[model samples]
Target: VAIMGRNKKTLDEAKSKLGNGAVAHQGDVTKFDDLDALYAKVDDKLGKIDVLVVNAGGLTAAPFDQVDEAIFDSMSDLNFKGAFFTIQKALPFLNDGASIILIASIAQSLGFPGMSVYGATKAAVRSLSRTLSAELADRGIRVNTISPGPVETPIYGRIGVPESQIDGMKDQFREKPLLKRFGEASEIGTVAVFLASSDSSFIVGEEIIVDGGIVNI
Candidate 1:
């Protein structure tokens, strides 16, 4: 297993938790040079890729009226452009039957406050999956997306939520899902694993929503 991130410390920590089989590559997905280096390292260390997950992104929240040019560009650069180039750069290194899983979000389907730019970027990713699947079908490579809801992760804290209001925010998120709880990180990982495996061979160009009925119910 190989992981890439812009932060060395967090990358190292995740790599340690992933065990000895996992390797960490420090690179920013937004930079083409960095992506090239990452795939080069992957080819040198592990050979052709079997599974490619374009999962590097973050949430930047602001009302449409208050969103500045910097915010707009930042969201587009990290979420949309980064995902596009990551897959493009990996083409040569990907095996013929490789699985490509893009991490979208339920935000793409719903209108949430302060998420206009963020949501639009995710929507673009979902669209990319459909088009790419058709383009790569001749090569036997499957491209799909997983749109997760409110998963339990450190993302909330990183998003500038006040400490005192964090629990309240979580409560609101829990209520959005019919399951009445936040999704575990492991649950999302399980879905990704299934998509990566041959079990989902026929499930191409589809977005498997793992949102606990938030979108459907």
Candidate 2:
């Protein structure tokens, strides 16, 4: 497995946890040149990429009236443009039957306050996954998305809210979810693993929601 992100310590920790099966690289998702360099290193070491998970994205929440052009552009540039380019740059290194899993959010379909720009970017990702699946079908590469809801990660703390307010927001999220709890990163990781493996061989261009039934009901 090859991991790409800005957090070198986190990536190193993940690599240690995965033992010898993982390789860690520090790169920004927003830069195609950085990704290309990482891809080159991976190719030299791993030969080819069999699975590409475009999972780098963040939420920038603000009231619609307060959202400025720079804010919207930053969110879209990182979430959609970065994701699109990651796949594009990895195409040459990807094996024919490679699986490409894009990480999206249930916010894309759900009406949530202070999430319009973030949700729009996720919606674009979902749309791209479907279109790319069809476009890459002839090459036997499958493109799909896992739209997760309220996963308990560092992102929750960075939702443009005070730390004091996060617990209350989390409580409300749990109550609203049918499962009565926020999802774990591992849950989304499991879905991603399945999508990247032959277990989901017949599935393509589908947005699998691992949202604890928050969006379905």
* Local distance difference test, each candidate: 0.91, 0.90
Off by over 4 Å in 1: 161-166
lDDT of 1 by residue, 149-168 (tens): 98988888876546666788
Q: Please provide, for model 2 over 38-152, each residue's C-alpha lDDT reduced to its tens digit, 9 standing for 90 to 100.
A: 9999998889889999999988888899999988998998999999999999999999999999999998998788889999999999999999999999999999999998887
Q: Where does the lowest 10-residue lDDT sum fall in candidate 1?
A: 157-166
Steric collisions counted per model: 0, 0
Model 1 clash number? 0
Provide the TM-score for each candidate, comma-separated: 0.96, 0.96
- Deviating ranges (above 4 Å) for candidate 2: none
Clashes of 2: 0
**After best superposition, candidate 2 residue 75: deviation in angstroms?**
1.0
- Which candidate achieves the best lDDT against the true structure? 1
